[model samples]
Target: MRYIISYVSTVNPDLSNTDIAKLMDHVNVHNNTIGLTGILIYSEGNFFQVLEGEEEIVKRMFERIKKDSRHYNIIKMLDKEMNDHSFSEYHSSFTVISDHYSQTELQEFLNKEKDYNPEHYKSILYLTQKFMKLL
Candidate 1:
């Protein structure tokens, strides 16, 4: 089965921007071999990411991510099986939300998830669509 998982995590203060870039590069390479696709957003020392792939593999990946020392306070925001891949365009696209979108827009965008849309994804989809075009 195909699955997608989204989570928000606190970035470890000790790591620099270069370290995060290197980590994402490593993740992208590993994700490619495993058939995963998604986007990662980092801003204000927090990471919001969506990963999609085979169920077991994605679960395992999330587990490994949970244990990675580079980030903490992992909070899963979405988990579901999907008929089609929503993020097939990239193996692991990275976006710094602050770079392309204003903090006000991002905050306003994030504050309005009272319910999920018909497709089961919520506000994250909107954020993904806007950022995906930038890459």
Candidate 2:
């Protein structure tokens, strides 16, 4: 079965651009090796990432992520088995959405129940598009 594992974290103050690049490289290698797909969103000092892959592979990746030193305050926002992979194109994609959402939008997102947050995903997608425009 496919699974979706999402997490939120903050980058460590000591992390450097080189460190971030290396970590991304490591993630890319692992994702390619295991056929994983995902997107990572960073905004306002927080990061939200969603990983989709075989249940075992995704879980293993999450375990490694938990021990990674690039970030802290890690929280598993969502981890559930799914019937299909939602994102199948990229091994992983990165976005910076420092201005994607307003305060009201963020509040509405946070108030949503776990199972009723399609809008939140939509917002993330919108942010990704915005980030892409800057590329």
Candidate 3:
């Protein structure tokens, strides 16, 4: 009964990187205690998070996330049960898709989870691609 929920949200402009790091630190500890794993990508005031774990726990966490005051306009791009977690090793990976990931870096990120269901990530990938083009 594993689930992966991917969503994007508009982050509060006043929040700084240090604030995000502190938040992720707390989230990582809490997620680990509940056996959840995922990555969080934030760039240009947008947050894309992929959360995976037991169905009920994941759903509960998502519900809390939706109610959090830190972000708003959350759009869930994918939500489905899966046999395995794509982000097994990372509790809460944070990435900023900036100029630092131009050549081999960005490709490295995309190549890691090629076996996962592409349909589940099509919208996020499309947005990432478009963002890359602008850089």
Candidate 4:
């Protein structure tokens, strides 16, 4: 079965912008190599991410994520088996919502995703808005 997990986490205060960029680079490369697809948004010291892939692989990745020291206060908003992969449009993606304009653009892009589950889409939008408001 395929699985999806979405979560928001507080970034480690000690990390610099360069560190975050390196982290995003690693994520994109590793996820592509492992055949996972998802989107990640970071803003205002928080990260909102959705990862989808094989059930066991996704679960294992989440476990590893829980152990990563770059972030804390992790709150998983969604996790379940999924019959469809809504984020396959990209192998893996990352973005930083720095301002209202970026947030609006991202929201518009997400809204245009026809394959995304409405419930999941709404949940993501809520989390994104929450993070953006903190910026």
Considering every candidate listed, which one attains the maximal lDDT?
A: 4
- Give each prediction's root-mean-square deviation over alpha carbons: 6.3, 7.2, 4.5, 4.7
Give candidate 4's root-mean-square deviation (CA, Å). Answer: 4.7
For residues 32-104, write the lDDT of model 3, one tens digit per residue: 7788877666666777777888999889999999999889999997688877665543344345534443323
Q: Tell me the deviation in Å of residue 57 in model 4.
A: 0.6
Give the Cα lDDT of each candidate.
0.66, 0.61, 0.69, 0.72
TM-score of 4: 0.75
Model 1 regions more than 4 Å off: 89-135
Specify the highest-TM-score model's number: 4
Higher-ranked by lDDT: 1 or 3: 3
Tens digits of per-residue lDDT for model 4, 3-109: 88888999999999889888888887888689787767777788888788898888999999999999999999778877766565222223454545545445554
- Per residue, candidate 1 scores C-alpha lDDT tens digits across 1-135 of 678788878899998988878877887677877788766766567777878789998899999999999899998877877665655433333455433333334343334332333443454655454544332
Candidate 3 regions exceeding 4 Å error are 93-120, 128-135
**Model 2's lDDT to the true fold?**
0.61
> For model 2, how does the per-residue alpha-carbon lDDT over 1-135 read when each residue is reduced to its tens digit?
777777778888787666665766677677767788765655445566778788898898899889978788997766777665555433333444233333223333333422455645555545434434442
Superposition error at 134 for model 2 (Å): 9.9
